[model samples]
Target: DDTPYDTQFCNWTVQSRFPSNQVTLGPWVNPTFLVGDFGLLRESFKNQEWGFQNWTTRRLQLTYNGLSWRDTAQVQFSMRRKAYWYTINIVIPSQIMWVMCYSSLYIRPDASPARVSLVVLSILTLITLSNRAFDMLPIVSEPVWITDYLFILNILCCAHLAQFILLHSALRAQDRRKKRKQQQQQQD
Candidate 1:
């Protein structure tokens, strides 16, 4: 089955509509033997991550269309899956980037050029990294936790950047007023 990488492929049922004498299912899991070198990469499987959980098979009966004569058999299996690489690679890096952006607020607001440049670069980098992270995951209508975090962090960074710009403008005007007062005092 073509499933998303993050999905845990568990509890699959194989149903047969035809009348069955009996449905016997003995499902077993043959774990892939991985060497030390390849074990960490087990979850890197295409489409589905590595499923290490126990598999169970159970037989069940079903009725269809209110037909008393018709019988159905189903075999269900459960397996556990893991998706660690995406979290380690994409999630961690994005969080670190946000931390860096937050720390930029400590820069002196009087340094207008440096502060502006840093804010612009941080915004651009965050947006680019966020895009890359989203591209790694399948598109969905709801936003994931990481997506929400990134969006909120981006908003905070933008608000702080705007505040810094305003502070810088105010400081520049104050400095101009001070210079005018000093000049007037010297002439007097």
Candidate 2:
């Protein structure tokens, strides 16, 4: 599936076989003039989760076999997925998870259980959110904007976890050194 902001161009053409001279078909400037149920068409597009944009209409005369000329009317438009829905459901939640994941850095490294649990939980929740986002979208060969965003978040989470691990190891080593120094002082 393409990103919410990604637009798709579409064209609809109506051609009449009547000779241009005998009967003039259309230069339908208004969609309502072209289709009696223009509102219905708009609602149907909305139902399909697309927002219509950049609409234009053109009239042309086409000749076939160099003998007959026909009247043609064309409607051109662009469509995009409704972005507000994605912003509310996927983007906001993912951002919150990212914030929570990074916030683990503030926790004292000595409290390994709390710090590790916070980071791990954030990672798990982010993964769940990413999966939910993908489930809402149709499968496509290429990655979309949401996919890239989630991937970046995943990388950041891993980095934070690695930092915590290193910090915890260093603290433990320092504590061991302090204990050894105390024992040497007592023996002396």
Candidate 3:
């Protein structure tokens, strides 16, 4: 699922009513033999999420179906989802959220509200993004690469929050020691 390119092959058989003994099927000699309108063909396969890939027609063949033999021709088409859409919608935004989470580390430890809020917001945004990405994909037993990327981002956000918690705790402890020393000095 993580692959950038997706290929799908469809076989369409045009079977002849006459048996191989009476008639035979052969590949089109002319490039534009049966193809009527090129524009219409392209438009029919056009998709928003998936771009149209190349299509090919296989050589004609004679096959037996118990009762009689027939001639058949196959046409296959391939298409792939546009990577730019995913990159724009999911990847870029998640990267921005990660940057925001990382930036919280540079904030002063005393500013607990700002630092905590930033990390928390980043975590929430990442969760929403992950959900959105997952919704776009079909459900499968195996994990997807986009989900894995988001999971890593969530972990990084958590690590940033943990760092902030530790810093805040140490700052509080230092303040408490200073207060205790001042109280003792005043009493003395």
Q: Write the per-residue lDDT of candidate 3 for residues 61-140, one digit (tens) a residue.
A: 47566776576556566677788877898899999999999999888888889999999999999999998987887777
Off by over 4 Å in 1: 1-11, 15-56, 64-83
Regions more than 4 Å wrong, model 2: 17-45, 138-143
Residue 30 CA error for candidate 3 (Å)? 12
Q: What lDDT is reached at residue 21 by model 1?
A: 55
In candidate 2, what are the lDDT values of residues 36-101, reduced to their tens digit?
322213333454567787767666787867988777666688988778888888889888888988
Q: Candidate 1 clashing pairs?
A: none
Which pairs clash (backbone N, Cα, C closer than 3 Å) in model 3?
none
- Winning candidate number (TM-score): 3
What residue pairs clash in candidate 2, if any at all? none
lDDT of 2: 0.76
Better of 1 and 2 by lDDT: 2
